[model samples]
Target: MASDQPARRATIHDVAKLAQASTAAVSRVLRDAYGVSDDMAARVKAAMKELDYRPHASARGMRGKTYTIGIVHPDLRNTFFPDIFSAVAEVILPTSRQIMMATSEWTSTEDVFAAMHDRRIEGMIVVAPHISENKLVEAARQAPLVLTHRHSYSTAYDTIVSDDDAGAELVVRHLAELGHKYIVHLGPANGRLATQLSFVTAKRARAYRNAMESLGLGKFAEVAGCPHYTFEDGYRAAHEVLTRSRRPTAIFAGTDNVAFGVIQAAYDLGIELPRQLSLVGYDNTGTGGLGPLSLTSVDQNPHEIGTLAAKMLLSRMDGRESVERASITPQLVVRRTTAEPFE
Candidate 1:
């Protein structure tokens, strides 16, 4: 259905011509060279985007750097993911490079890898990739890559992850401090890969159970979860927990999106949050900041994560390719959704 003849990709001159800016002015804006006004930079970027102008990597190759990178995110719908995406954008914007984004499900990373194959994309930033470790290593061999959220000691690629285990412990300890003996851990059952050492949810779930048992509340420790990380999975997992013979007084949902589903299910069951059921979510996403949601969650500080990942990829693209790993600390933000269990 498409034309066989390849269309001409827009060029930097086209952007400069349309923006009414000189070639030097356009170059300075893209390279983040000093002295470009905000207005000038904005105008150049807008014109470039409008014309779909891509600075050819081939031309930059003579200068020993490609002006393009690819970013693959976990999911498009998850509010938490977009924050990370923007963070990556902020970090790369000033470097005179471009970022092309794509979404990949926990089930497949093919769409993401396809972006990597583009000749223009000299480096990749894969956020919370759901593919296997083996596949990741192969991909890294093909291009400079930085994997965020997936943790491993392999020297093949770099990684930046938050302390998810500690984060889960914080939630468990907070619930225990609240006298919530009967607590449930609701999370995605993202198959065997979820059980891998690279997966954050798997780490969090293990930590939650361990923390609860360590507090001598082994009798109340319950891990009810499903295989997918989505709203429907959360609703079903929460519904199962609430419909049990003895419902938990508090719950720790894996992510904020999942917590939203739990909230709706609880509301349908006439359960008031924090009064009848307390909840804590992970990845304090944008939606969680809403007054109505005000979700208590673990803040992974995805901004930091995204920025760090971009920088790491840049380092790799700069040819410093030994291996690097960084961990960002996680913090718990208590909100209106969590409270002391009722009598």
Candidate 2:
């Protein structure tokens, strides 16, 4: 007959006993605390691995350090975000800290922040936060905060962003030089509000208009708004604009994901790219560089942005007081998607 008793889970004490070390020594190894020796750390880690022992995050938090950093982003489908995330991981690899990621795809940004707060994350890096500045400032009071893709003058947190204005100008000027007098910009509609004008999409749209005006193409400049940055929104918006009587010879999409939709929509409509329509997208994602797509886009140096954001957050965690801001310049990578308009 088999015994009905439950198996006991491995604990730190088990780890210490297995490693022939005291509980205090095991604790020091787990915390990555100072004064831990190389040989002792190797023995303790091996013992823990053999025992399959995992530290309780809540218990670790009770001791005043979770050794976890939280990263928040709007969408996980965007490939550009992974570049930033990988860079951040590289910077934190040498430290004891680990990263925890949260996405606002199905919940509000506020809810995500609250969840991170509950977990007692040591620091936070919010990418393209949709929340107001006041709310952000309120959250910063609880933990070290760093923001990417947002331009705020608040001294409460550090900011890392790419120059959206310059990037937008680059796309518009490129299309204009390709003999595209009728050019349209497709971007998110959510940023139309007065308060949300600081958003990257809104800034890009404004810069596109300004660049077109400067090039004497103001009369032909148009902006088609997408409800979201998803591929479906891009496809729908493209259909509407491409079907118009005065169809734009060129379209500048707010993101590569959106540009992908435009490509599909143009294909469905029997329109040839670079002949009937020239398209450019922001965020030079890897998928966009595929042979079939070969999309023209602007590179915002997401890796550099992520690296800086992680460093800034770590600095704040280390008790840096003054606010800091860092910006990266954007570069346009022309591919096979764009060319001079065909007569």
Q: Estimate each model's TM-score.
A: 0.84, 0.89
* Candidate 1 whole-model C-alpha lDDT, 0 to 1: 0.84
The candidate that wins on lDDT is 2
lDDT of 1 by residue, 125-222 (tens): 88877776788888888888898887665788898989988999999999999889998888654566457756877888788878988999888877
Q: How close is candidate 1 to the true structure, as a TM-score?
A: 0.84
Q: 148-255, model 2: which lDDT tens digit per residue? A: 987665788898889989999999999989889999888865434312666887788888889999999999877787756789989999999999887999999989
For model 1, the run of ten residues with the poorest summed lDDT: 188-197
Off by over 4 Å in 2: 1-29, 32-52, 189-195
Which residue pairs show collisions in model 1?
189-226, 189-227
lDDT, model 2, position 83 = 92
